[model samples]
Structures are given as structure tokens and as C-alpha cells.
Target chain A: GAGVSQSPRYKVAKRGQDVALRCDPISGHVSLFWYQQALGQGPEFLTYFQNEAQLDKSGLPSDRFFAERPEGSVSTLKIQRTQQEDSAVYLCASSPGGGTGDTQYFGPGTRLTVL
Target chain B: QQPVQSPQAVILREGEDAVINCSSSKALYSVHWYRQKHGEAPVFLMILLKGGEQKGHEKISASFNEKKQQSSLYLTASQLSYSGTYFCGTETDYKLSFGAGTTVTVRA
Candidate 1:
């Protein structure tokens, strides 16, 4: 695709259930980031991937959140034992390798609602 | 910590101008501006990396002040298409912190 693409545009799961979200970044781009945005709040960094390596994940809220980019192209974020507080929009963004001067393109994001 | 954006919401008519402000409590190395429409992800508008440089995307522009730890986005001749939420992300200490956002409504 021409831009970052995210799967499961919307998801609703009962509390304690597990859910997985996927993202396909732009081809050849070397940087990928995951963010979580709660209602009426700014997007908070969750994790960052440089190719197949998960470089930074200091922003992950807890141990229940995990993300992986095995091939460096497609990535998945998994949440275990979902809680009502986990409801939020999960956004995926990608930028070319380099630095802050580069532009990061974002996907529509997945709106997850844990019931 | 994240930055703070003023004027949580603004309403304007076509050809009007609007200004949105973002302030941080810490020194900044760069500031990034993005606009997000309803139900869509954010799109980059511009970036100000220096203390005195200004950037423009068409009639939309932004300015940064490294000393004051603040940045402002300017919109000239506002168009209906400009109605959306604007977010300012500040880069400092190797991390990017974003403001809550400012929503602008441009009417015909």
C-alpha cells in the first residue's frame, strides 16, 4: 500500500479476553511506531520498531501489552486479559530510517473497545 | 512531559485567520505540527527544528521559539477543509511529547 495500513479497524472484546492488532507499514521504510490514544487525549508512544528489532518499548503500559515485528514489515500488538480501561484507539506510524526530520505516515488506526 | 496547547477549540469562517499556540515546560530541540480530521489519522503539516525558523505548508504556517519553549501555528484564509484537530509534538531529550490538541472549525 502507499501508506501505513492497520487491520481490524474496530474491535470489541469482553473484559479478560485477548485481542491482537496488526499493522503493515510502507515498503522500504525502516521505522515503525505504535501509540495509544485515550478519549480526549494525545497519542502516547507505546513502542518503536526499527526493522525486525523492537528497539524501544518503554511506553508500554504493562506486561500485558506486547508487540513484535518479526519481518520488519508487518507487526502485531497483543493485549492479554483485556480490561475496560484498555479501550482506546491504537495507531501505527512509520518513517524512513534517519531522524526527526523525516516524516512519519500514520494509519487510520484500530478503535478497540473492551467491554 | 507533554506540551500544552491553547484554545482547545476555534471556529472561523472562510478567509478568516486563526492562531494556535503550544507551550512546553522544558527546552525543545524541535517541534512538529500535524492535522487530523474526524475519523482519520494525523497528517504532517510542518516542522520547526531551529530557534528562529518558520515553516509553511501552502497558506498554513508555523513558528517556533526554542528559548521560550513554545510554537505557534498560523492559518491564513481559512478554508472549510482546514477544519480539524491540530497537534504539536515537541522533541527534546530524544523523546517526542505531544500536546492534547486544538480543534478548529472552519465554516463557509
Candidate 2:
């Protein structure tokens, strides 16, 4: 792909519904990141992956949120028993380098609306 | 942790200059600059990793002062295309934190 790609541009889910957001990073990008952005706020970090290894997940708001990159390219962010607070845009980003400050190319985010 | 950014919002006439700042409470390993247009994904502008190193891309430039735990982005002779929210994200100790962005509007 030319750039990072995210699936299900917009999703509406009732309370307690489970939803999954998928991301396909640019070819050969070794680093991946997930973020959540609420209305009128900057994106907040959720988790990070270097290839298939998840290095940091401390930013995930709750244990109900889980992410995985099975083959080091396609990633999924799953929210179990969604709540109103989970209504936010989820962004996925990728980078060629795993080192400090390498530019992360972002994908068009998935807007998740939880009722 | 969130880095502190100054001037929550700014409006500028095209061709003018402006500066946005970011300061962290702890030591920083690197500082990143990104621009996000309304309804679009953010695009990386530059990264400042070495202490006292400065980098520029087009009319946008950024600097990092490691000793001060701060970084600044400078927009010289701004263009209408430069109108967007600017965010400063930092990396330190396995943590990557982004500041509350500075919203910038460049008018004709």
C-alpha cells in the first residue's frame, strides 16, 4: 500500500457491543502505533508495536482494549463491551524505523461511536 | 505524561511568522513535529533528536534544546496551506507523549 490504511471508517455500536478496528501499515514499516482522539482534543497514545512485538501498552485506558499485529503488518484493535466513553476516533500510524523520532505515517482514522 | 504547549490558539495573516513551543517536565530523547489539517490525518513535519539540532521542511522549522527539556516549531512567512493544528510529540524512556496541540489558522 502507498500509505497506512485503517478499516471501517465509521462504526456505530450500542452499549456493551464489541467492535474491532483494523489497520494495515505501509509495506515494511517496522513500527506501528494506535491512538484515540476524543472530540476537540489531541490524539492520545494507546499502544505501540515494533514489528510483531508490542513494546508498550501502558496507555491503553482499560484491559478491555486489546491490540495485536499477528504477522507484523496487519493490526487489530478490539474493544470489549464498549461504553459511551469509548466513542472516539481511533488512529493508526506506522514508521520505517523503531528508533527515536522517526516520522510516523498516519492512516485515515476510524471513527467509533458507542451509544 | 503530556508536554506543555503554549498559545493554545493563534490566527495569522498569510506571510506572517509564528512560533509554538513545547516543554517537558522530564528529560526528552527526541521531539517530533506534525501538522493535522481539519478532517485529515496528521503528517509528520520533522524530528529533532540531537541536542541543539535544528531542522526545517519548506517554511516550517523546529529546534530542540535538550538541556532545557523544550522544543519549538517556527513557521516563517506562513502560507494558507499551513493552516492546521500543530502538535509536538516527544519520546523518552519507552514512552511517547504528545502535547495538547496548538491550533493555527492562516488567513488571506
Candidate 3:
């Protein structure tokens, strides 16, 4: 079976440009999450979704970040007025269940570079 | 908050042993361990639930200490395939907070 996958494996944007990253979770996955990983650092949580509900966005760094998982499948993370600080690897993960101990399978990630 | 991982980094030869520790400030319901190589997504290694249960994968094993709010990953007879950055994600509710990560390098 295909694993979770992210589109535009690499994206370069101007500091003020807006960018949208896409994620395709594994088939039948019910839980989805987004994270940001800076160079040489751990991945920081961004947001989470269960089906079509955006359950946790507390990890989102700012109002400029927005995410949607419409129809309970594919998800997108949009950044408005991107900043140099927003440059990092955007990772998406999904688990079969929304339970506490379910293991998350990750995508290759989309590396965004702000010039 | 993000958990704290010890020893930041380690280097070992094949067939050696290494331990990576993760400590959290708050109570945890579960702990997940993952390994990521350069330019790749993290691969799930194992998960330990609240009961302080221990799980193993091949030569890798992990233990969760609920009372101490900590987890330790044990890599026995390490192989070159084990070289990567290991992250521990601690979950209190449904959301998981991951540690900074511990980088391990295995040489022949």
C-alpha cells in the first residue's frame, strides 16, 4: 500500500509570497497531522485533523498558518505572507486510528525555502 | 512542551550497544519512537503505552516509565542501518509533542 505522501517535494518562494503544501494520507487513515522541522532540529507540531474536523491547531505558530482537511482525506497547509523563518521541511503524518497509542506514518515532506 | 533527549548524539561501531533517553515534564499517556535518516521521513520504531510496558523490534527495544515520565530506547548489537536521528514523541492527550532528537552514528 502507498504510504503518506506530500507534493512539491521542494518549494522555493519569495519572502512575501504565499505557498500551499499538500498531503495525501494513507488509505483509510483517520488521523492526520502537520509538523515543521527546522534544520538540525526536531519536528514541531503544527496542526491535527480527525476526518474533516480540525481538532488541534494550538501548535500552529501564527495566524498566518492555515490548514484544511476537507472531505476527511487530502489536507493542505497554507502560509500567508511567508517569512524567512517559515522556511523548513513541512511534514505530514497519518495513523489508521485516532486512538492514543496509534503509530504515525510520515511522508517524505516538502522542503520550503524562502528567498 | 517538547520532551528532552539526552546525549544529543552518539557514535558506535557495528555490534555495539547504545541507549537514548527521553524525559517529559508532564504526565504522558503514550510514547512513540521514530528514526529519520537524512532527507527522509521519520520511520516509526515502536510505541509504549501508559502501563510502563516494554516493546521490542529486532534488536531495538524501548521502556516507558510512567511514574518517572520518561522513556529509554535500547539498541543492542547496533547495525549501520541504525544510524539516524531518533525522536521520541510523548502524548498526553491526542496530540504528540516530540523531543529535539538524538543522532546516532554507526560505523563498521
Which one is best on DockQ? 3
Which of the two, 2 or 3, has more lDDT? 3
lDDT of each: 0.90, 0.90, 0.95
| Candidate 1 i-RMS | 1.8
Provide the lDDT at A83 for model 2.
98
Model 2 DockQ class: medium
DockQ-wise, the better of 1 and 2 is 2
In terms of DockQ, which candidate is stronger, 1 or 3? 3
For all candidates, the clash counts are 0, 0, 0
Docking quality class, candidate 3: high
Predicted candidate 2 versus true structure: per-residue lDDT over B8-75, tens digit per residue: 99999999999999999988889888889877888889888966899999988998999999999999
Q: Which lDDT tens digits does candidate 3 get at residues A19-115?
A: 9999999999999999999998888889999999999999899999999999999999999999999999999999999878888999999999999
In Å, residue A96's CA in model 2 sits off its true spot by 1.2
Tens-digit lDDT string for candidate 1 (B3-69): 9999999999999999999999998888989999877998989888976799899999999988898
- State the weakest 10-residue window (summed lDDT) of model 3 chain B: B91-100
Return the DockQ of model 3.
0.83
Q: Report the C-alpha displacement of residue A66, candidate 2, in angstroms.
A: 0.8
